[model samples]
Target: MRIGVPKEIKIHESRVGLTPATVRELIANGHQVMVQENAGLPIDLGNDKYREAGAQIVDTPEEIFAQADLIVKVKEPQKSEIPLLREGQVIFTYLHLAPDPIQAKGLLNSGCIAIAYETVTDKSGGLPLLAPMSEVAGRMSIQAGAHALELNQGGRGILLGGVSGVPPAQVVVIGGGVVGTNAARIAMGMEAHVTLLEKSIPRLQQLDSLYGSRLNTIFSTTDALEEYVTTADLIIGSVLIPGGAAPKLVNREMVSRMKRGSVLVDVAIDQGGCFETSKPTTLADPIFTVDEVVHYCVSNMPGAVARTSTFALNNATLPFVLALANKGYRRALTDDQYFRDGLNVYRGHLTHAAVARDLGITHTDALNALI
Candidate 1:
């Protein structure tokens, strides 16, 4: 199998799909790996490192996309790259299709087999490939929100961890999943008044056991959301629905009623967003004001910490990458139901149900598409 790693082209995105160590492992297993020139250079994983690991350094993304059987990438294929896709070629990356109709249409028209890293599952029902980035984004949400809360950043000029006589900022996290948990943990650690809302009673109970009195865990509801959202100084939107679009828990009306200078960090922006006013922002220009409330919705939050994020992502994705290279996508996907969940598009057919439903497109089961 010939595998290709292209330099991520998204604005402010610097993570490479494969690390040098992982490339070496693939080469040792008899797979040929082609890396775009300087794909990992910005992160200090230079071309020489890949060359020493037995990878062929290509000069352009065209060479890689044209020749490689499997194209590995960090972010979704951009509009320009979409035209390079060929029938039956495999594209493995984070394809957030629910919110982006343009990308979805491009993939459907390309006739390529697309697997989304964010939707891949583990036996524990956890998104193994998405976890590391989610963890990074979750932690960074607090950091970004804190920075955005300053008066210069179009925020309320409130400090998250206030001084002796001043009260700390009120932090609200919507969801109790990986992103939400990490966000809440960091907020609490900063001495902010943290409140977490979760729809699952079992999950809420679990969080309660974990944090006890240190955190406030509330049942997620319309009233609960409105109550907390209105008073929150920093509202972190961490809700997710797997391959589906994130539910808009914070409506425009709710956002309009928020206190002036309140900050919203939507970690769920990749899957649309939990906040109604949220729009994907780049790291270069990460925040926008909506109804006087600051919205920090950088879609690729983990990309801001590219080096750590790349290594962490490579650690989780390498095993699955090996499986696909070794047995081919069909066998690798068919053999593992959890892995099959990653197949969002198969030769132009939408293979993931949640993505299909959310996009209002025809759906095909991954196994059926494999046939």
Candidate 2:
């Protein structure tokens, strides 16, 4: 199989789909890998590195997409790349189709196999591919929140870990999954008062037992969230419902309840955000003020640190990329239930229910495709 890795063209996106090491491994597995020139440049990986990995370096994304059997990418395909897709070709990437209608239309018309990393599930019901980036984004949420808390940044001018004679700032994290857990951990590490909210009683009990007196867990409700935000200095929205639009737990009316200049970091922005007023921002202009409350809703938060994100994302996606490339997506998915769940679109049909419901499209069983 011929696999291609294109340089990410999304505005301000720097992470590459495949790392040089992963390229080397794909070649070792008897697959031909094509990497566009400077594809890994944003991640500080040089053309010589890919060349040395026994991979061919192409000059343009057009060439890579036109010729490769499988296209591995770090983000969803942009508009320009849409027409370049060929029918029956395999595209493996983080296709956040739930919130993206335009891209969904193009992929469907192109008649290609689109497997989304965010939808893939593990035996334990964990999102395997989205986990690495979620962890990265979660940790960065607090880091960004901390920066946004600075007075110079139009924040409340409160320090997360307050000095002696002053109380530490309070942090409220929505959700208790990978993103929330990681955010809570970082906030706790900063010596801030952390409150984690979740709808799952089991998860709440688990977090409570795990953190003991160091953290506080709350059962999520409208009244509950409203009450917490009233005094929160940093609100981390890490809620994710998976393959669906994230519920807006924080509404515009509730925004007024937050302390003036407090920061709201929506880590779930990729899934359309859990805050009613949250809109996607870029790393270049990462934050914006809404009614005096700062909103950090950069959907690709992990892209800010491309090198680490590239390596970490590649580690989680490489095995599956190899799986689909070696045996073909249909055969490989037919053999692995986890991989099948990853199938969002196959040959123009919506195979993932979340994406289908999201776009109001029809859901086709992935197993039926094998026949």
Candidate 3:
């Protein structure tokens, strides 16, 4: 198998699909890896390093896309890269297709087998691949929100951890999954008043047990969200629905009533955000004001911390990458139902049920599609 790693072209996205260590492992497994020139240079994994790891350094993305059987990427293929995809070629990356119909249509027309990292599951019903980045994004959400709360950043001029004379800022986290848990942990660490809301009673109880008196765990309800959101100084939206679009728990009316200078950080922005007012922002211009409330909705928050994020992501994704390389997509996917869940598109057919339902497209069972 010939695997390709392309430099991320998204604005301020410095992460690469494969690291030198990962390439070396793939080579040890008898797979040929082709990496775009300087794909890892931005993150300090230079071309010489890749060469030392037994990867062929291609000069352009076109060559990498044209020749490689399996294309591993950090982000979704951009519009320009979509045209280069060939029938039966594999694209393994984070394909947030539910909210982006253009990308979905492009993948379908290209006739490529697309596996989304975000949808892949583990035996524990966790998104193993998306977990690393989700953890990074969740932690960064608090940091970004704290910075955004500064008066100069157009925030409410409140300090996350206030001085003895002042009360600390109130931080509210929606969702108690990987993202939410991390967000609340960091917020609490910062000495801010923290509250977590979740729809799952079991999960809420679990969080309550874990945090004890340090964090307030609340059962999520329409009234609960509205009340907390309205009074929150820093609101972090970490809601997710697997491959489907994130539910809009915070509506425009709720946002309109938020206190001026307050900050809303939507860690779920990659899945179209749980906050109704969130539109994807870039690292170049990370935040914008809506209804006088600041919104930090950068779709790729982890990208800002590329070196740490890249290594973390590699650790989570390497096993799946090797599985696909060793047994080929068909055998590898068919052998593992969790891996099969990653199959969003198989040779032009939409195979992931949640994605299909979210996009209003027909879905083919992954097993049937592969056969």
Candidate 4:
């Protein structure tokens, strides 16, 4: 099988689909890895590194998509790349389709096999491919929020960890999944007053046991979120629903109530955002003010730290990539139920129920479709 690693085309997306090490692994498993020229530049992995690892470097994306049977990417394919997709080709990437009607429809028409990273599940209902980036995004949410709190950054100018006689800033994190937990951990480490709202009691208990006194864990309710968010200096939106669109936990009304100079970072922006006022922002101009509340909704939060993000993402995705290349997507999914769940679109049909429901389209069960 020929595996293609195209340079990510999404704006501000520096993470490459395959690292040099991943290329070497695939080559060792009797698969050819084709990497586009300068694909790993932003991640600090040069083309020479890939060549040394036995990956053939191609000059054009057209060459890669033309020859490679499996096309892997870090983000969803942009409009330009959509034309390069061919029928029966396997595209493995983080396709956040719920909010992207256009991309979803495009894939449906392409007759390509689309396996979404965010939809792949583990035995415990964990998203394998999305975890590393989620971790990076969660940790960075605090870092960015902390930086955004300065008066110059359109924030309250209050220090997150105050000096003696000065109280720390209050940070409210909605959702208690990977992003929320990591955000709370970072906030707690900074000595900020951190409150986490999660709908799951089991997850909350897990968080409570993990950070008994370090953080405040609360059962998330719309009323409670509205009541407390307005008083916060930093509000982190970290809600997720697998392949489904994110629920808007913070509305414009909620933002209007927030104090001037307060910052809201929506980590769930990739899934259509958890904040009503949230719109995808780029790193160049990563913020906007609505209702006097600073909003930071960079869709690819992990991309900000390219080297770290790329390596971490490779760690999680490499194994699956290897499986797809070695066993072929069908055999790989047939062998592992976890990988099977990754199948969003297969053989020209939308196999993921959530995706079908979102677009009001039809779908068959992935297992049945694969068979």
Candidate 5:
């Protein structure tokens, strides 16, 4: 098998798909790995490092896309790269297709087998591949929100943790999943007043047990959201619905009532955002004001911390990458039901039910599509 790694072309995206260590492992497993020139250079993993790892360094994305059987990437294939895809070629990456019909249509027309990292599940029903990046984005939400709250940044100018005489800022985290949990933990660590709203009682109880008196765990309700959101100094929207678009929990009216200097950090922006006014922003220009509230909705928050993100992602995706390489996509996916859940598109067919339903495309069973 020939695997290709292309340098990410998204604005301010510096994360590479494969590291030198992962390339070396693929080579040792009898697979040929082609890496675009300087693909890892942004993260300090130079071409020399890839060369020493026995990877063929290609000068352009065209060469790798044209020759490699499997395309490994950190982000979704951009509009320009979509034309490079060939029939039956395998694309393994984070394909947030539900919200981006253009990308989905392109991939479907290209007749490529698309496996999304974000939808891949583990035996514990956890999103193993998406977990590492989620952890990173979750923690960074607070940091970004804090900065956005500064007066110069167009925020309310409230400090996250107040001084000895002042009261701390109110931080509200929506959702109790990986992203929300980490956000609450970091907010609490900063000595701010934190409230986490969750839809799951058991999960809330679990969080309550973990944080004890340090964090406020509330059962999510319309009224709860209305009350907390309007009063929060910094709000983190970390809601997710797997491969589907994130629910718009915060409406435009809710946002209008927020404090003038308040900040909103939507970690779920990659899945179309949980805020009604949310639009994808780049790290280059990460914030926009909606109803006087600053919104930090950068679609790729983890990309800002590329080095750590690449290594952490590699740790979770290596095994699955090797499986696809050694056993081929069919055998590897058929052998593991959890892994089969990652199959979003298979040679022109939409195979993931949630993504298909959300995108209003016809669904095909992954197993049937494999045949």
Candidate 6:
């Protein structure tokens, strides 16, 4: 099998799909790996590193996309790259298709096997491939929110952790999943008043047990969201619905009612955001003001820490990459139901039910598509 790694082209996105180590492993397994010239250079993984790892350094994305059987990437294929896709070619990456109908249509028309890293599940029902980045994004949400809270950043001029005689900022984290948990933890560590709202009672109970009295765990409801959101200084929206679009928990009215200079960090922006006013921003220009409330909705938050993100992502995705390269997509997916969940599009057919429903596209079972 010939595998290709392309340099990520998203604005401010510097993470690479494969590292030198992963390329070397693929080569050792009798698979040919083609890496775009300087694909990992932004993160300091130079072409020499890949060459030493036995990877062929291609000068352009066209060469890799045209020749390789499997194309590995960090972000979704951009419009320019979409035309390079060929029928039956495999593309493994993060495809947030629910919110981006353009990309979904492009994949469907390309007739490629699109495997989304974010949709892949583990036996524990966790998104293994998405976890590493989610962890990074979750932790960074606080850092970004805190920075956005500075007066110069157009925030409320409130410190996350205040000095003696000054009260700390109130931090509300929506959702109790990986992103929210990490955000809440960091907020509490920063000595802020932290409250986490979650819809799952079991998960809320679990969080309560884990944090004891250090973190406030609340059952999520309309009233709860409105009350907390209105008074919070920093609200981190981390709600996720797997491959579906994130629910808009914070409406425009809510933003209008929020205290002036408050900040909103939507970690779920990649899935269309849980905030009504949220729009994907780039790391270069990461914030926008809505109703006087600052919003940090950088869709690729982990990209801001590309080196760590690339290595962490490679660690989680390498095993699955090898599986697809060695056994082929059909056997690799059919052998593992969890892996099959990653197949968002198979030869032009939408294979993930949640993505299909969200995008209003026809759904096909991954196994059936394999046939």
Write one digit per residue (lDDT tens) for candidate 3, span 1-371: 99999889999999999999999999999999999999888889999999999999999999999999999999999989999999999999999999999999999999999999999998999999999999999899999999999999999899899989999999999999999999999999999999999989999889988989999999999999999999999999999999999999999999999999999999999889999999999999999999999999999999999999999999999999999999999999999999999999987899999999999999999999877
Question: Candidate 5 vs. truth: CA RMSD?
Answer: 0.6
- Runs in model 4 deviating more than 4 A are none
2 versus 5: better TM-score goes to: 5
Pick by TM-score: 2 or 6, better one: 6
Please identify model 5 stretches exceeding 4 Å from their true place: none
Report the error of model 6 at residue 341, Å.
0.4
- Per-residue lDDT, model 5, residue 288, is 95
> Measured by C-alpha RMSD in angstroms, how accurate is candidate 3?
0.6
Candidate 1: give the clashing pairs: none
* Cα error, candidate 6, residue 17 (Å): 0.3
The CA lDDT of each predicted structure is 0.95, 0.91, 0.95, 0.91, 0.97, 0.95
Q: In model 2, which range of ten residues has the least summed lDDT?
A: 362-371
Q: What would the TM-score be for candidate 5 when compared with the true structure?
A: 0.99
lDDT score, candidate 5, position 319: 100
Model 6 regions more than 4 Å off:
none
**Number of clashes in every candidate structure?**
0, 0, 1, 0, 1, 0
Clashing pairs in 5: 156-261
Worst 10 residues of 5 by lDDT: 154-163
User: Residues 276-336, candidate 5, lDDT per residue (tens digit)?
Assistant: 9999999999999988999999999999999999999999999999999999999999999
What TM-score would every model get versus the actual structure? 0.99, 0.98, 0.99, 0.98, 0.99, 0.99
Clash pairs, candidate 4, are: none
Best model number under lDDT: 5
Q: How many backbone clashes does candidate 1 have?
A: 0
